[model samples]
Target: AQSVTQPDIHITVSEGASLELRCNYSYGATPYLFWYVQSPGQGLQLLLKYFSGDTLVQGIKGFEAEFKRSQSSFNLRKPSVHWSDAAEYFCAFFTGGGNKLTFGTGTQLKVEL
Candidate 1:
């Protein structure tokens, strides 16, 4: 069975500080990995994705993640976060067959001034 897990249920970081969100996955083969951010009452926006190329991938809003196959991890990191960045982030994976997607429970980020 393939699954994605986000250890943190919630995270609070001061505005303009660095942020890191932990993500781990269990899959038999290399899967399509993605990070999405969703603002309150809105649809999720794709932050980045790792298909089959480089281990490091960058995305919108100054976000980047490194995929470590051995570690089974794809963690998101931001050097400096903004208050607007506060939202729910979900780590998702695709099985690469039917366009099906599995999402983590999600991590809510709170930006403190």
Candidate 2:
């Protein structure tokens, strides 16, 4: 079984501040994890992915994540968040039992000046 958990339902960060979103996952094998961002009432966009290789992965919009196998975590980070970065972020992974992706509930980001 593979599952993702984003404990934070909502988060607020000041503009230009560094941000980190928590994610935890569980699986039977080496998991392939992914991060996606979506605007309100929109589809998800891939942020980054961790298939196999170096634990750290980078993606668009200056986002990055580090996969920690021992802790079963893949937390997303940004050096400095912008106002436009405010959106619903999701953590997902393809299940071994099924080909489709199972996503976490999601974490909505709010940028405040």
Candidate 3:
């Protein structure tokens, strides 16, 4: 069984500062990596994904992630974060065999102005 772990339960960053959220996974094979962001009272929005090929993948909302197979990590990064970027971020993994997705507890992001 695969699992996702988000070490940081909460993260605070200053607005306009660079941001990086950590995500580590435990899986036998190369599973799919996904980063989803959800605003308060809103549904989850896909930020980025890593399936195959290029290790580095780009996503919407000025987000990008690099799949490191050796490290078993798919960390999300943004050049600069905005106040609007404050939200709960989740890390998920899909084995591709099932429709189920194992997700992390989530990391609440706070952007201080």
Q: lDDT by residue for model 3 over 11-63, one digit each (tens)?
A: 99999999999999999988988999999999999998888999999999899
- Assess the local accuracy of residue 86 in candidate 3 as a C-alpha lDDT between 0 and 100: 98
All candidates: CA RMSD (Å)? 0.9, 1.1, 1.0
Between candidates 1 and 2, which one is better according to TM-score? 1
* lDDT for position 59 in model 2: 95
Considering lDDT, where higher is better, how would the candidates rank from best to worst?
1, 3, 2
| Residue 1 lDDT in candidate 1 | 74
For lDDT, candidate 1 versus 3, the one ahead is 1
Worst 10 residues of 2 by lDDT: 93-102
Over 27-47, each residue of candidate 2 has an lDDT whose tens digit, in order, gives 888778999999988988999
Q: List the residue pairs that clash in candidate 2.
A: none
Number of the candidate with higher lDDT, 1 or 2: 1
Cα error, residue 101 of model 1, in Å, equals 0.7
